[model samples]
Target: MPQHHTLYAAFADRIDAVLTALEHEGVLPPGTPRGNVSVEPPRDPAHGDLATNAAMVLAKPAATNPRALAGKIVGHLEKDPLIAGAEIAGPGFINLRLAPGNWTNELHAIAEMGADYGKSGMGEGRRVNIEYVSANPTGPMHMGHCRGAVVGDALASLLEYAGHEVVREYYVNDAGGQVDTLARSAHLRYREALGEDVGAIPEGYYPGDYLVPVGKAAAEEFGDRFQAAPEAEWLPIFRAFAVERMMDMIRADLKLLGIEHDVFSSEAALQAAGKPEAAEAWLRAHDLVYDGVLEAPKGKEPPEDWEPTQLPLFRSTRFGDDQDRPIRKSDGKWTYFGADLAYHMQKAEGADELIDIWGADHAGTVKRIKAAVAALSEGEGKAIPFDVKLVQMVQLLRDGEPAKMSKRSGNFVTIADMVEEVGKDVVRFSMLTRKPEAQMDFDFAKVVEESKDNPVFYVQYAHARISSILRKGAEEGFAPSADNLGLLGEDDMALVKRAAQFPREVEMAARTREPHRIAFYLADLAGDLHAFWNLGNADTQKRFIVAQDAALTGARLFLAARIGQVIRNGLALLGVEAVEEL
Candidate 1:
């Protein structure tokens, strides 16, 4: 086994050793900051296998010209057995082509590592708490919450693969006014179940028929005990019952899309524990909170009767927010920001880092919550890493027109509807085919189209094709073997190079906190495999099962098998299945 598992990582270490040698020989100055140096594949593959900007980055610090420095670096790099060719490009970039055997070794690594080929240890086992798809417990999961749910779940998986302890969380908003409205709605359905005419749902109540079941359950358990009770008497009991039922529906919908959370923190519980009161006292003691009058709202016409009231405000302006934010209203009730701050504080207690996946509509509140985290952590003499990722809305469409809303949800298409129509794999993969911050159109006609244009189908088809080839090769008495891999040609090595990039892609995607990159990388890898497969159409000799030469057939099957392994690994990270048959 090599010191570094991936080809690129191995070469990066080799470049570092060369720089250290140069420093020892006094050719380059010692203690020069090498943080800016980078080793990666050239933008143009024609340049070489690997390119490094070490000389370009260190030339000024070494007090020499970039090209001159590059020559010295190349002189040291060319001596290694792995370097088939090392040359200086136009200015100072050093491009080195590895011996074909190095890529062959990577293919062998894939076989040995199997499903663990692309897994990394970069996170060092740090705990990460990720809260995503925390839709209010007032309704079932809808298309509006689908993208963020997938992104967050995939990100949690990605971080785990990169060696982090991840806690998948959903913050239940059962303490809000929405749940109160849910109780009232469930009460109406309860009355209807009790043989009373409730008429049409009122203007402010939830009209979805999904609540009818909850109402029936209430009617069954209580048996008209609260049928004629006062609003105050049954509000609390019904609120808890309705919220629990809604959460059950939400969980079932998420399961259809293969998402599950590890934690379900409640806002009401946090308040019950006096977390907000403690947070407020801490902020006040540190002078981060004080009673102040709020200014007029921005970007709006001021009302003639608008009045400012003094309230306890957090000094968010000190941390770059536009204005100081009130933590509590004049009536002494905690505001939403106050509760959220305390919730984050609770989250920070258990993890080294915190990430919240929020809808784009919450963009306005990101800064304040971040500021609160900053204040709280900095006040404690240590700052915890915090990030808020805003996922934009997903527009559902059938064909080219807007899709119809589900009558069950009464507002938008439900997650269950999407999953049932297109299948879970299609829904998960389609949600991740684009960047989360950009608006996406989930066109039902386009996602399930069995063609190269559909990324999910194209990637899955590549795996299936490789599986078919391997099965036929076995039937023809040709088994995958690495003994004859040296016979592989340039076209075969091209596919090998693409498959070897999986480890690098995993590390990069985890570092950037962007799971969509895995989707994009798999699409490219699948394209490469399909291109290689099409070569047999031009010439029969290019096919994998060459009965005349069993060695060549076995070697080609080995390459195909490894390519399939890499595809399976990438798809697993995206929570998509690599089907053996299309």
Candidate 2:
């Protein structure tokens, strides 16, 4: 027997004890490795409640037959008070069925914990920095940036539920050439704002009408003083003004999706502080960077004017990268990778773990960044883990046709327009329906439809249905109370078993850094609740409300309440609301 607060943890601990007992009995060698042991729910419910592959995994190491080892393990598991039966099935697997009362106890735990039921301490309060949706400070955020925003926010929430101190960060690309173009574009608009016939926007400048207002704002604030000024004088002023205004637009767009980063690190600020140069100097002293003549990139033709020039490069290949990455371009200017390396070096100083969520187009860049972090750790003699999660594109559809593109952001659809069309909740939920790295389609018609195929609607309706039942039961003078919980039968216990998996699912999602798993789990749990509710329509005896039997009605209603409680908790992790009614 093992003492753990959660059901799965208890079983896992007990399985470990069985292995240790086998070691003590001389059935296996002392100090045998048990990393491969896994206790999980069987795929087929008919197999048993819980299944362990301890024997199958450890048999070869113990110099024994798997079936024989399974028989020995089952004997020890059968003696546990909570286990009703233990049997060996399917090639050296031990399946154990818990007593029905154990599920009732688990339900009681849910009732006591309420919204906090699924939260776990698996992360152990480790500091984790999650950087996402780092759209450039050029214009408003478009639909292309929506998936990473939702995925990152939900992941932060999920990690918090699993006990990690998560820092939501956004890196602002304010120092790049994009912002320079924005400045020149705004300067053109600024000339027009002063009633000048600036003619058409120049070929290289941004053409979006959104910047017209930014120029107008600058004119109203600073007057015509900047119009007659030289390019050198006005360029910095316009760049600063345009970037601040664009960042404001980005913040407002993110607000519509309920996302606000804890820290907005600026690349310009990093460069201004000489961090990149300092990092380069540190790397050079450590022999991590060297002057090198690069070979032409394979699989792609080199530029016609390409020459074998000596430039600074990081030894990324030593850390598993495909090739040595250049830290400085041939022009002797620090490249974007150099700035990012310093940014991550700063991040590693504060956090134990770093996660950067990027759009799928940046997939080719993952290895070099990982190598940089690995080199940083090796140089500092302190290990820091880094991961990059790439979110794929989302194709928006309406009535099976591509969505109308937004003129506000030029060719791309703006986040504001999407939110205005289908509401923020639908947009957030739909973006998360598929894995972050897997491309998906968001159909406006399907997302708002009342059908069960719409995951958001399906999961929300389940919670709404439960609330309606609780209200109906209340009006009929039947209320749920803990004292009458034992009246729930085996069928109700089955639902509790499903609800009990929430904690495990939360841990798994957090461990994998995939919040979509929570959405999927909630969808399945919602399906189970819907199926359980329909059982009442076919048989009056299965109804949750029994007018003449308050005790039985109370027990069933308590189970329903637990189901609703779990639905709320799971939805909260995804930042979706659990509605009281459809």
RMSD of each: 1.4, 2.1
Regions of model 2 farther than 4 Å from truth: 1-4
TM-score, each model? 0.98, 0.97
Q: Output the worst ten-in-a-row residue range by lDDT, candidate 1.
A: 1-10
Off by over 4 Å in 1: 1-4
Query: Global lDDT of each model?
Result: 0.91, 0.89
Ten consecutive residues with minimal summed lDDT in candidate 2? 1-10
Candidate 2: which pairs clash?
A: none
lDDT of candidate 1? Answer: 0.91
Task: Give residue 95's lDDT in candidate 2 (0 to 100).
Answer: 86
lDDT of 1 by residue, 1-582 (tens): 112366788898899999999999998888878888888889998898899999999999899999999999999998999999999998899999999989998998899888899888888769999999999988889988999999999999999999899999999887778888999999999999999999989999999989999999999989999989999999999998998899899999999999999999988888889999999999999999998899889999779998988989999998889999998877787888999999998899898899999999999999989999988988877798999999999888889899999989898899999999999999999999999999899999999999999998999999999999999988888899889999899888989988888999999999999999999999999999998888988977788887898889989999999999999999999898889997
> What is candidate 2's lDDT per residue for 184-302, written digit by digit as tens?
99998888999999988778889888898998999998899989899899999899999999999999999999898999999999999999998899989988899998879889899
Candidate 2 local Cα displacement, residue 84, angstroms: 0.8
